[model samples]
Target: MLNKNLQNTKFDIRFFILCSIFFVVTSPFASCSAPPKLKTQTLTITRFDKSTITLVAEIAKTEEEKEYGFMNRKDIPDGTGMLFVYKKDIHLSFWMKNTPLPLSIAYIDSKGIIRELYDMTPYSLAPIIGQYACRYALEVPQGWFSANNITVNSKIDLSSL
Candidate 1:
């Protein structure tokens, strides 16, 4: 009986440890893909008409940061956005899973020129894929591009990033 009780105690401890690990791994981001706010920098957009607009950008340099994106974010103030960076120009894709904010994404070439612009619906499961090779993607509140007169071929000053 004493040996059986010892084995049962060991099993209980192991089960408790496994459950604790599971909670720790999944608890922080368990609610609606909520992610911690990332680092921010000043980014400037030079429009095709030669006018310039400056905004603050949250830099998403890591894969995890890029994946979480603005998920569960309810409010995106005007003049602020997120910048997703890559090592080289490639086909860029995005989805609005668990993201409630309607956004406009500008796919930018390695030279910092806007290649394409796409408007994304909130919580949309459809993938918004880019045909052009792009090194970066900038997401802002919907209609921000047209509102600011920033259109395709506009130069984004990546050097300031």
Candidate 2:
């Protein structure tokens, strides 16, 4: 019984140490922070083909908006979506947790050029990580990008708003 107790104690110590190490290593970099202030607004998106489509988007500019995201939402109105803005470029990561509507996300670079597009599954915890660094993310209804001819290199005219 004494040996069993010692083994358990050692395991607990090791577990605690591992957790501490992980925290120390990742503390400086914000993995996931508070949600940002989201606002319902509008923006014009210019496709690679020179066609433009305007959308009523909820701009996620604060930490609170980013965290809450589209969670618990049943639908995104037609011609409207959500846009996440970052101070600088980052490898954008997104997931659908408690979000019932399927979405397509576009990673936009600092120049407002669309760098990547990915379809996301509804209510999925699996992360959709961007392969390139970007300063903004736009989330719209699934197939919205393709249907509207929005593709890589498309511009999301971020200069105005």
Candidate 3:
């Protein structure tokens, strides 16, 4: 009777351990939640013609945020974009890996003037490098710059952001 009881106790312990492992393996999938929405800021672009355009941009200030720019997004609203802020002027490179939006990025200097512009293909791993050192980068839907007449040297008004 004693041996039988010991065997039953061992079986119960093994069963509990297996159940714990199963829960640990499946917990992430079972309790998964939607990703948090990014924070947005208002920014304005001033063309050489003196005309101004306003945009609502998600601010990517942290390294993690900058790395995850626009990834998995199904769509971006018109007049919406992303602003990647850096602490200092540096040669910045961006890639479209895991990002679904067709985007155009403008590398901007500390004075808020766009220094270079490049169009990025969706999901491409190729790096789109800035032609000059930049303190910020603005990303909008592909063709937005040309369609709106925004080009290199166009000023971005970050005072309101």
Candidate 3 clashes between residue pairs 3 or more apart in a chain or in different chains: none
| Maximum-TM-score candidate | 1
Error of 1 at 69 (Å): 0.5
Give the Å shift of residue 73 in candidate 2: 0.4
Q: Encode model 3's per-residue lDDT on 1-161: one tens digit a residue.
A: 99999999999999999999999999966523343467998888899898998888999888878877887778988889999999999999999977888999999999999999999999999999877999999999999999999988899987654
TM-scores for the candidates: 0.80, 0.75, 0.78
Model 1 worst lDDT run, 10 consecutive residues: 28-37
Count the clashes in each prediction: 0, 10, 0
Regions of candidate 3 where Cα sits further than 4 Å from its true position:
1-36
Question: In candidate 2, what are the lDDT values of residues 1-161, reduced to their tens digit?
Answer: 99999999999999999999999989965534544546677788887668788898888887878878887777787799898999999999999987889999999999989999999999899999999999999999999889888899988888866
| lDDT scores in order | 0.92, 0.87, 0.89
Q: Per-residue lDDT for 1-161 in model 1, tens only? A: 99999999999999999999999999976775548669999888888778889989999999999998999887999999999999988999999988888999999998899999999999999999999989999999999999999999999899865
Top candidate on lDDT is 1
Best to worst by lDDT, what's the order?
Answer: 1, 3, 2
Candidates ranked by TM-score: 1, 3, 2
- Overall local distance difference test of candidate 2: 0.87
